[model samples]
Target: MYENTVPFKIHSDYTPTGDQPQAIEGLIEGLNAGMRGQTLLGVTGSGKTFTMANIIEKTQRPTLVIAPNKTLAAQLAAEFKAFFPENAVEFFVSYYDYYQPEAYIASTDTYIEKDCDINDEIDRMRHSATSALLERRDVIVVASVSCIYGLGDPSDYKDLMINLRQGMICSRDAVIRKLIDLQYVRNDFEITRGAFRVKGDTLDIFPPSSEELLTRVTFFGDEIEKITEVHYISGKVMWNRNYAVIFPASHYATTKEKLDRALVTIEEELEERLAELREQGKLIEAYRLEQKTRYDLEMLSETGFVKGIENYSRHLTRRKPGEPPYTLMDFMPDDYLLMIDESHVTVPQIGAMYN
Candidate 1:
């Protein structure tokens, strides 16, 4: 029966031999025995990834492969892309080419601030990974440490999505507001990802951090009458989505009302911090904090913007202290299959991240 047969066809010239067969068999046996996790202990250049892929083909379950670094993740992603030419093979890594997290050195009394430069290519890959996972049963995501970082709750992310059906009565202004609520900015001048341009009743959206098709939202006077997908590089419409639900362009997707509440909370925190500083005879720090926060509040109030906004993400999320931060993993379904490429290395890192 097809159910008992391997769902994939192996096209490689070489076949599994030596310890590879043994490793694959052991892993499969462990999985069948209700072992939720198994490690493939093999040396470098042992073709461990290949063995993992073979197991996946035999099981025919969707998989995720987590790697150690960007270089390794990229190599694994490329390999999976080649192996599963017909499947949704994706890559996820840090979107920042360089990042320095904010730190406070109380001894020297220094606040090392968070700084980062976004890598568009990596950001696009991250988007591709989540999008592919939601759309298909066969997907492989080779990722780095970025996967464990804080992100928007997937439930909220999915909830914010707006499905635009063909001939649906979607108001132009309503669609624009939805896009904004999803953290997509309206930039009539700049035509970049996560930004939309309005040409009369027509809207063109270059999805934030995506490697897929550019979505076009065209309206007929007030209603979103048609939605089409176009090639980002070629500027060609490939297909029309009977319906399209746009996800938040960024991790921070807060409504205006929410932002107002956040501002209020921030103000309260600022006052509390100021009082603490003053009590400790940190007059300089108190003044510095007051100035910085006042400037930030002004910026937030004026243009609805502030620098290094993610530093306050914990407060913005409104989660209890010590609770785990949300991440891309939350975007995955409950039954989503996961495969760690270098399980011996990856499994440990997964546990280490929580601490």
Candidate 2:
């Protein structure tokens, strides 16, 4: 529904001054000359973000600005949102408010399982970021080092999306199935984010990327008769449209065939690993790995997902061994811009994550 193309225009009361003008011009010139990387050295309060915004507007290319941490990323995203009010300015960071990595201590013979609590709001914002990238070019995503981490395949995400247009030949039952396949819950009693409800010929869908509106589609027999945005609570129509697009409820979008293929590959990889472990005479470790892998496989077969399915992302997306995982940057076009904030610090942080 929100695939309208537009130019980025900064709605700011302040104007560029000091080195700001030179920095902006130099950056634009470098981009025009096909420079892959360019830095704008500036101290605190030097309006570097504003300068970057100007560069983005001039270049007219989608930009991803990475900060070293979530706080800084949030600040940059807010400023960018203020500047480009009409465009998509998304904040993306690790959704976990608290995270503890899984570990095993040989000395103490202790196994500390992985544990973390994800912030729902942050998760929603992350979905918003990916959705914006897929739908439009006028997007500015301010992300932390977590941006380097795997975010699933964007092609699969865009391909599996539910695109409903008025007068299309789609049955209400088919729409329900599409939502469920996209991981949307059917909450008939109350409409919540990532949920859908049906009543008679109308279907209400609350997309994960949308915060304030739900899409209401009316069906006349097997044809989509109406599509519109409605307030989530009041159910008042906000906007009428001839088209609507519903992204996956989560990033890891896979069809049944793809999942089955991934499962087989995962089993093969597990066997290979187990052979090495057995050859090394690590029998206890080998048994533990086999048991765990089988348990995960069973869960995936029944529920279509597991808690740490991302660990087997290579299998799921069918990528080569040691290949860099698909990150948020992969969602953007090859010509899209990357602006690293506080490069001296953030650059090293990115390296740490990569390592």
Candidate 3:
């Protein structure tokens, strides 16, 4: 496991003024006294954000700030990143730029499949947010309602991480296999995100955790020689590191063993569902469900993935029916602080996550 002991220190030029200091102190006191929640009300120009930062510093706990929308989340993320530049400040919102939900109209007998355009950078940052929660302390994730939605199982995601250290004994073939298991693609020609390449004895791993740095694992015969961080664009050796960790390329990462088990469970569920539909004399529905499921199963067996895989997350993550899906909140420690921006609006949005 990764370790981070740094306190939540703020680097703001302006100190708390007016009621800001009082509010910060009260919040910290409440937290220390085991209060469940406390509200901080402030008007415009009151510097509420700064007050929250101070509270976080005094409490010295990681925090998750939820906003009602993406724009507010982004703005808050930028501000917190500036305030705690030494810590891990991450942004996490929905990747979809524009999303139209899949729908069916029985009157018109129309089926409209969902369509979306994902912002790659946002998706990468989402991965970074979850990774930071698992690998580091002093983290602040400013997210939108998308965070309350289903996310990958935290246990499985953490288990998929690959830890490496300089001078460790490991074979090249074994390293490559581990990378593949972490969903890293092998691209010998071009270097990009979540890709690995071999140049002689050096294995350049383009980890998805960082957008700017690439991990260079140079092997001397059967033993590990060195580990260094390289700039992705300039190809300059930034610095040498004693240890390195590679997070999964995709958040929904799983081992082939789990995948095999999930496939069997999914197939059994499909049979049961189809039988229920047939008993209700819904032959067309049963046939449609079978067709879709079989096609997905075939894709999973052949390519290890299928579109809309999250729809089967219960089986994929080995959760029982009616069990609550894991969300980004699950990645954070239980004692982590939570701040809801514009709670009057954001609270309702969070409450409607399952509705």
- Name the better of 1 and 2 by lDDT: 2
Give the per-residue lDDT of model 1 (tens digit) for 156-237: 5566666677788868888887887776788887577888878887787877645667788888766667889887667788
TM-score of candidate 3 against the unseen true structure: 0.93
Ranking by TM-score: 3, 2, 1
The local distance difference test score of each candidate is 0.74, 0.88, 0.86
For lDDT, the strongest prediction is 2
Greater lDDT among 1 and 3 belongs to 3
Q: What TM-score does prediction 1 earn? A: 0.84
Quote each prediction's TM-score. 0.84, 0.93, 0.93
Residue 298 error, candidate 2, Å: 2.3
Alpha-carbon deviation at 18 in model 1, angstroms: 4.7
The digit string of per-residue lDDT tens for model 3 on 1-355 reads: 5486577888977998888877888888898899988999988778888889888888878899999999899999988988998899999999988888777564555667768887878888998899888877789999999898887788878898888888888988899988887778899888888899998899999877678888999999978899999997788999999988888887777778888999999999999999999999877777767887899999877756677778878887899999998999999998899999999999998888767
Q: Is candidate 1 or candidate 2 better by TM-score?
A: 2
> Model 2 clash pairs?
none
Q: Which digits, one per residue and each the tens of the lDDT, describe model 2 over residues 207-289?
A: 88788899999999999999999999888999999998889987886777888999999999999999999999877777778
* Candidate 1, superposed: residue stretches over 4 Å from native: 1-22, 100-114, 232-234, 255-261, 297-305, 343-354
Per-residue error (Å), model 1, residue 119: 1.1
